[model samples]
Target: MKIVDKIGFDEILLQLAEEASELSQAALKLRRARMGINPTPITCEKANLHLLEEIADVTLCFGILNLSDTEFDYIEHTAKKKYRRWKKRLGIDKE
Candidate 1:
């Protein structure tokens, strides 16, 4: 096994997780606005901009993995599947 794999490079994943969490939090704030859950609702546009930046940060960390195209394809496929499932559960997706 490669030294990097042996080491597990966990720190990168930690950062990715942090960024992803921030993105999730931002999305939740937007959802609050849309659902009228907040008394003083957040601006959807500002929340979205923050979410976009967090998404970019997460993607940038992904490049540190140096994964092959096939690996990326697998990740993309699985992520899309999960997204679809979540969307369906939220009733945001008709089909």
Candidate 2:
């Protein structure tokens, strides 16, 4: 049986949520470290490494969720649209 089948979908979703939260925290920590805003200062390299680790964890969670091709395509489309909007907002849209 597949690992997801053994773990159940709900548990996997919960794990995804937890990993996403950790990713968010890692991003915040990296930002704070970069800005020198932390009371316990961390090296930028260490902060970046921590952020990378969290990103990997969240990515692994996403992989385990087994999204269908249609769902994956939709996400890619939406992400591209958002990227365009973001570039326009920043006055960096080349097209």
Candidate 3:
């Protein structure tokens, strides 16, 4: 958190991009390694934890990005979409 204030706007955006790429990598580890398409020796827990961390990083980046635009509609849409998807997948929804 201390490092957060030390950086500039553009640097934070760059970190956001880098974090996105890391999220992609973590997803690939789950999809490819689990499917036997990749032999990177990744456990599901490890990959999922990495994914969770990457998502946290992206959200932290958004905290900085949101300083520029308070009304970021995409954030709302994405949060709802992801929440719905996860709830459905985890059997947390009535329907």
Candidate 4:
């Protein structure tokens, strides 16, 4: 099915972006703490690992690269078809 025909792509992308940004901020905080004079590498590594897990959870929820090959192929085909139609309507060529 087309992206529009399925759930809203923009909303899904926005949610994924927000989740990624949150994970990035958490990682930065862990990095800064690890660079201190008395750094705790083990603690920092643990926090980073948790952050990675959270990222993976978000990715799975967003269905980003987690779908089966057949499902992904269908999504790609639908997206391309919609994109071509949109471009043509807007007078854009596939150059």
Q: Name the candidate that leads on TM-score.
A: 2
Candidate 1's residue-wise lDDT over 1-95, tens digit each? Answer: 65346656787788779888988987887777667756434677877787788889878878776789999899999999999999999999978
What lDDT would each prediction earn against the true structure?
A: 0.80, 0.89, 0.80, 0.72
Clashes of 4: 0
Task: Give TM per candidate.
Answer: 0.66, 0.91, 0.65, 0.44
Error of 1 at 41 (Å): 5.4
Query: Which window of 10 residues has the lowest lDDT sum in candidate 2?
Result: 35-44
Residue-level lDDT tens digits of model 4 in 7-55: 6667667767878887887777677667876565557777777678768
lDDT of 4: 0.72
Ranking by lDDT: 2, 3, 1, 4
1-95: candidate 2 lDDT, tens digit per residue: 87699999899999989989999988988888888855447777898999999999989888888999999999999999999999999999876
Q: If both were scored by TM-score, which would come out higher, candidate 2 or candidate 3?
A: 2
| lDDT for 33 (candidate 2) | 81
Which regions in candidate 2 have their CA more than 4 angstroms from the true location?
none
Residue-pair clashes per prediction, in order, are 0, 0, 0, 0
Candidate closest to the true structure, highest lDDT: 2
Considering TM-score, where higher is better, how would the candidates rank from best to worst?
2, 1, 3, 4
User: Which parts of model 3 have CA positions greater than 4 angstroms off?
Assistant: 1-5, 68-70, 77-95
Report the lDDT of model 1 for residue 31: 77
